[model samples]
Target chain A: PDEGAMAQARELQGRLTKPAGSLGRLEELSIRLAGLARTCPPPPVDPAAVAVFAGDHGVHAQGVTPWPREVTAQMVHNFVTGGAVVNAFARQVGASVTVVDVGVAVELPPSPHLLDRKVREGTRDMTVETAMTRDEAIRAIEVGIEVADRLLDAGAHTLITGDMGIANTTPSAALIAAFTGADPGVVTGLGTGIDSETHHRKVEVIRAALALHRPSPQDPIGVLACVGGLEHAAITGFILRAAARRHPVILDGVIACSAALVAAAIAPESVTAMVAGHLSVEPGAAAALAHLDLSPLLDLGLRLGEGTGAVLALPIVASAVRALHEVATFDTAGVTDA
Target chain B: PDEGAMAQARELQGRLTKPAGSLGRLEELSIRLAGLARTCPPPPVDPAAVAVFAGDHGVHAQGVTPWPREVTAQMVHNFVTGGAVVNAFARQVGASVTVVDVGVAVELPPSPHLLDRKVREGTRDMTVETAMTRDEAIRAIEVGIEVADRLLDAGAHTLITGDMGIANTTPSAALIAAFTGADPGVVTGLGTGIDSETHHRKVEVIRAALALHRPSPQDPIGVLACVGGLEHAAITGFILRAAARRHPVILDGVIACSAALVAAAIAPESVTAMVAGHLSVEPGAAAALAHLDLSPLLDLGLRLGEGTGAVLALPIVASAVRALHEVATFDTAGVTDA
Candidate 1:
């Protein structure tokens, strides 16, 4: 992103009809987009694609949630069939969605929209063993980078991160605590309407894993290999790739935010490409986004994580950019500001 | 809205995949829309119309703001030509905009999209005399009701309130002070970048108007006739008509909020029909929303009042309704609770 273009965008904003800084963060966001696009007013961000990375968490065996592990694959099918909330939202905003089987435990049949990019069938239970081999973690990341590149090549100007892994928030909490140095209890949240007993067990399991692993925050991939889901690693890679390409990545929910913490650690500049789409109710999401200095566009108490938040934000994100190209300047309107 | 329909909507929400209250206010808004539509899932709130009420205030002679009074007519022309920020935003969200010259000081040459419903050529200086005769106030409100009915009859499922009167927020502040019983200095803002001295004078102007009128909180129209602009009176009628017809009315900025206070006082049930789109930095807007017990959808420090805030919120409001219609129930999706 160029400082020159950002300065030019701010100048243009000043010439609009409203008072200075009246548009607030939308003004800043539009300027940021201009800087990224290397133009005073960036090209329209259209033809958005949401990549829902599907995986399985071995931590489900710890009784962190009551949802069956197979529900992950079933919900992926729902996404494909355009029956999920994300599907409805994407349709409303005219964006497309794709599901990437990054590491789902089942060997599903091939589908047109489902990208088969499994690095491993599932991760090892973090309390028993490292979630994945370091090599497997790298493979998932490379898959994510490839996904971003392919989506861009196929004409997607904007990318959104989504994840599908039951009980994934357990490792998400641990990963955020390891990176942010927060206590497990502070970052842990009820993942999916868990009973009080299950919630306690979930937090304790994350604490046990962090104590057993002692993953270094400085070594992002090492942390992922030790206590992260494959989808998290891939989302980290996805965010990094978007930054490398100077494109925007709208992140959804706790898992994507945890992945962002890892991505930002590996490449501090990657946070520039990320837009916090919504502040998910999951406790770790706010902690992670706050550490990253990102404010979400929507906060609807949305707990669904299949890029639903990002999908809902598509029109808003696009409108902020669109105003740059479409709105009349005060000079053009023959109106003077106070 | 029917209580039976609201009860059915609540039951339907419980059957959805999320927990009972996981969606928070989005859930509440959806149920309200359902009750208004008399269905568990409301019909799509498509074909939204934003009525930008353009007028001029005679109070400009008092130097409440630095902008020229003719700028109101100029912005109306900007709106008619689809060149203003409101037009840009309305186009972005597939919503249409109409400029109602309810009391523009200048007579605009007829344009197809401009509603020439001028009740009078603005109003008298409120600090010196009544802003409008009681008969003129009622006429302006009736014009607003007609505008709402015409828009809805022309197939606009949702109505958004927009205002364009120079120095209008001055009267807005005075009216809010009269209704909410807040001090003039507390509710007054630099309407459009006034210096400290001008801001203080603006506060004094509102204070003088309130002291001279001593408007009753119980008689809402009396307040409008005393200190409100023609645009505010019309928007009040527009909101009341929408509520009577069971349509959602998205409110914008301090001027619209002030009008909504009038509407709510006249018909207390009208609050059910109102949706606060954004919280403007204008101190009076927050006070008005708080007094009305309404929470805004977005708060991006927006003070642009040509329906920009409400238009930016179109997609978000629509998605909340869409979720009720499209998201799969837990039993149908075969997904389990935590």
Candidate 2:
């Protein structure tokens, strides 16, 4: 990101026909985008690609969620058949959807939008052992980086994070607690609707994992390998790759936010390329976003993941840059300023 | 609105492939749209129409703002020439922009998108006398209703409110203060950037007008004639007519919010069709929206009216209904629920 371009964007915003700061957050978003593009007016954020990383969580065996582990494979089919909520939202925003099978237990047959990048069938139960070995974690991350490279090479102007994994929120809560040092209760919430008893058991499961592994925030990869889901590792890699390329990436709900924390810990500068798409209902999503110091673009109480929130915020991100490029300055339009 | 359709929409939302209530506010919004359209899954709110009601305020004599009154007429030209912010946003959402000159001070020639319906050159200075006679206020309200009818007849599924009137914020603050029974100081704010001293003076002006007219909230027309701008009255009519036809009307910034107060006052049921597009930086907008009991879809700090906030929110509103129509049910997708 270019600081000089940001300075130029701020100067340009002041000279636009509208009052200074009247556009509020949109003006700041545009300025940050200018820095990302290294230009006074960044190009439109369009033709976005949504990479939905599907995996299965071994924590489901511990009864953290009521949903069966097979639901993960079922959702992958739903996403491919364009019957999922994420598919509908992606269509609304004209963003291409690609499902990456990073760690689903089922052997998914080849499909048009499916990417077979299975590092393993499913993660190990963190209550008993690490979610994955260090090498397997790194391999899953590479899959994410490779998928991001493929999408960027295909001319996607932006990247949107999506994920589908049964009981994935259990790992997400553990990841957030490890990174932010927040209490397990503070970061854990009802995922896909859970009873009070289930929620309490989920929190204790996270606390037990943290007590056993003692993951350190300084070593992001170690922390990820200890408790993070396969999709979480992949999304972290996707965000890191996008940030390195100076392109913006829109993050979805709790799953994506937890991955973003990992990405930010690994490369502090990656936060510059990240956009918090929406404030999810999951309590951890807010804590992760607050720790990252990113304001979400929308707050519609959305709890569903799978990149739905990111796709919904695409127009707002595009409009911010479009205002910079399209609006006439006071001098250009010959309009008097206050 | 059909309660039966709303109930059916709720039933369908629970059966969506996603977990029940996972979509959060979007599910509620879809249900409301179903009631408004009298169908389980409402049609898309597309090919929308934005009617920017342009007027002038004689209250510019008060030195409440630094912007020249001529900016109002000049902005009308900017809108017609497709150089304004509203024009850029409307083009982004594929919505048509129509300028209705209900009360501009200047006599403008007709243009392709301009509707010549000037009720007067401008309202009288409220500090010296009533802004307009009761008859003129009624006529302006009638102008709003007629424009809404025309746009709805031309195949517009949704109506977005926009306004351009120099010094209109003074009257808007007064209208809000009168309708909400709030202190003038609490409702008045910097309109398009004003110094602290000017802001104080604006509050005093509103207080003085309220003191003089003693407008009653029950007599909605009297309140408009006493302390409201012509565009405010017209927007009130626009909201009323839209509600009568059971179509959604998205409200913009403080100007639109103040007018909404008047419309809701006249017919309490009109609140059913109103959608708060975004929370403006203006203090009165929040106060007015609170009085109307409507939650805004976006809170991006937009203060420049002209329907930019409403236009930005159109996609979110459309997607809410799209979810109901496109998302597969759990039984249909053959996915097990928790």
Candidate 3:
């Protein structure tokens, strides 16, 4: 991010016809976007790209959620055919959707807009063994970086995260607790609206896994490999690459929030280019966002994690930038200043 | 609102691919919109129309704000020329803007997209006398209803409220206090970034006006005539007409919210057809919204009040409806349901 551009944006906002600081968070958002674009009144955040990373979580075997693991592949097909929630929202915002198969348990048939970048079958049951090998986590992350490059090269000004992995919230809770040093019970939530009994079991599973691995937040990749899902690792790399390239990435729900914890841990400076799209009903999403010092744009109690929240917020992010680009200055409008 | 359509929408939402209650407020918003549209899935809120009613405030003579009263007429020109914040946001959401000269002090020139619907040359200073005669207030509201009819007849599926009036927040605070039984100090705020002295003076002005008029909330028209701007009276009529016709109307900042208070008082059932677009930084806006029991969709600290906040929220409103219309059902997508 360019400090010079941010300073210029702040100066520009003061000159806008509206009162100083009346736009509130939107004025700050525009300044941040200006810094990211390296110019005052940053370019429009159009032609946004959504990468829905699909995987299977071995924790499903532990009954963390009622949804079956095979549903992961089913959702991948749903996303590819444009029948999923993410697809509907993407269409609404004119953003293209791509499905990244980081690690699905079953073999997936190839299709357009589906990138087959499976690292392995699926992460191991974390309560019994490590989620994945360190090398496998790195490979999955590389897949995300490559996807970010592809999306940016194809003319996407903004990158949005989406995920479809049943029982993935188990790993997300574990990762958030690990990075933020919060209690497992505090970070875990009822993923997909689980019963109270299953929710307790889910929290217990996360606590046990964290106790077993004791993954240090200082080593983000090690923490990811030990307890994080392939999609989480991939999203971490996606965030890192977006920040490295000075483009904005809108994070979706708890899944993306946990992944952002890993991305921030690996590259602290990358946090500048990240935007919390919405506060999910999942408690871990809020915990991660609070830890990152980012305030979400929307709070609709959304817990579905297919980038639906991020896509819904695309218009808001664009509007913030558009304000800087299009609003007339007080002098130009010949209006009396307050 | 049609309870049958609302019930049908709730049932339809349960069948969506995502888990029940996962989309959260959006699910409820869609159901509410369905009831307003009287259908399972409401018609898209496209070709939305924004009516920016411009007026001058007699309260400006009370020295409530630093901005000159003439800025209201100047802003009317800025809105017509598409240089205001509301115009920028309207363009982003594909909503049309129409400036209505309901009570500008100066004789305005003819222009395209500008409606010459002046009821009077602004209102009388409420601290000294009634803001207007009761008959004049009723005429202003009639103007609002006529504008609503013209916009709806021209194919606008959604109506957005906008206002351009200097020192309008002084009257807004009085209206909110009169209707909600709130303290003047609690409802009054610094409009357009007034200094501490001006803010204190503004609150005193509201308190003095409320004391002088002692307006009755039961008689909404009389209250408007005593302590409301022409834009406020007109917006009340606009909201009433939209509710009478079973169409949704998005209310903007403090002025619109104050008008909504009068509208809801006149026709309590009209609350069913209203949507609070954004929570304005203006204290009166939130007080009025709370009294109306409408939760704002966006809260970006926007106090621009040219329907900017409402225009920015158009996407969220549209997306809520689109989710119900487009998202695949669990059975259709062949995914395991929770």
Candidate topping DockQ = 3
Cα lDDT tens digits, model 2, B172-283, are: 9999999999999998989898999999999999988899999999999999999999999999999999999989999999999999999999999898889899999899
Q: Per-residue alpha-carbon lDDT of model 1 for B304-331, expressed as tens digits?
A: 7889999988888888888888878888
lDDT of 3 by residue, A196-255 (tens): 999999999999998899999989999999999999999999999999988999999999
- Which has the higher lDDT value, candidate number 2 or candidate number 3? 2
- Compute DockQ for each candidate against the true complex: 0.65, 0.78, 0.79
Error of 2 at B113 (Å): 2.0
Tens digit of per-residue lDDT, candidate 3, span B38-150: 99899987878999998998889999988888889888888988888888888878899989999998899899779999999989999999998999999999999999999
Off by over 4 Å in 2: none
What does candidate 1 score on TM?
Answer: 0.98
Where in model 1 is the C-alpha error above 4 Å? Answer: none
Candidate 1 residue lDDT tens string, A1-338: 78999999999899887777777778898898888778878777788888889999889899998888888887777777777777877877888888899999999778897899999888889999999999999999988899999898899989999888887888899899999999999999988678889999998999999999999998999999999999998998888898899898889899999999999999997887788888898999999999999998877787768888877777777888888888788887888766
Model 2 lDDT, residue A78, Cα: 92
Give the clashing residue pairs of candidate 2, or none: none
Better of 1 and 3 by TM-score: 3
Q: Answer with 1 or 2, whichever has the higher DockQ.
A: 2
